[model samples]
Target: MQNDLMGLDSVLSQISDVRQSVTDMNAISIAPNPLSNGAVGQVSFTDIISNAIRNVDSQGQEASQKMTAVDTGQSDDLVGAMIASQKASLSFTAMVQVRNSVMMAYDDVMKMPV
Candidate 1:
């Protein structure tokens, strides 16, 4: 029985190692995205902001749909619904924070007695 348990542990360890290796490979497969010098000519900050806002809006909509599913008893996973709601809420809060920081910085710059 001791040998059996050791064999089982060995198998589990191998499985865990394989899983980590796969995850690492996936991370390496996705090349790093750097801001190119010509990126401004191709895509402005407004474009990036607009894209991000659109994505956040889409996520919010999906979260609402997930919530609706839960309310209608269509979703079996309440945790999944809750996670979606939290993600949407966090994304929205982040965007609001970003906006507030930018506004504050602009006000500070304007107030500079040059």
Candidate 2:
């Protein structure tokens, strides 16, 4: 029972971390960009989405490399590999959710009379 509680605590901690990460991402993406001429510019939506995709891809690649290292006996860090895999999976899932939300919003906008 104690082990189960510990595991649940760990899961909750990870969820909290993920939520914080998402909040940070939103804050960074929406934060004003300062130009060389001292003008504040808005970050483009495309740039934000592109950066997110790149980050997700990089995490996935890192996870794959970790798994491969473990598989080929190049490394003995099974726990680390598993953690990376989970992080990559979570990142991908979050990106998918964001994409779905954007699509739904677009559909709703299209359906509305302009």
Would you estimate the TM-scores of all the predictions? 0.62, 0.66
Candidates' C-alpha lDDT: 0.84, 0.91
The alpha-carbon lDDT assigned to residue 60 of candidate 2 equals 100
lDDT of 2 by residue, 53-81 (tens): 99999999999999999999999999999
What is candidate 1's lDDT per residue for 16-49, written digit by digit as tens? 9999888775222333347554332343568778
Query: What ranges in model 1 sit over 4 Å off?
Result: 1-41
Candidate 2 shows a clash count of: 0
Give the deviation of candidate 1 from the true structure as CA RMSD: 21.2
Displacement of the residue 105 alpha carbon in candidate 1, Å: 0.9
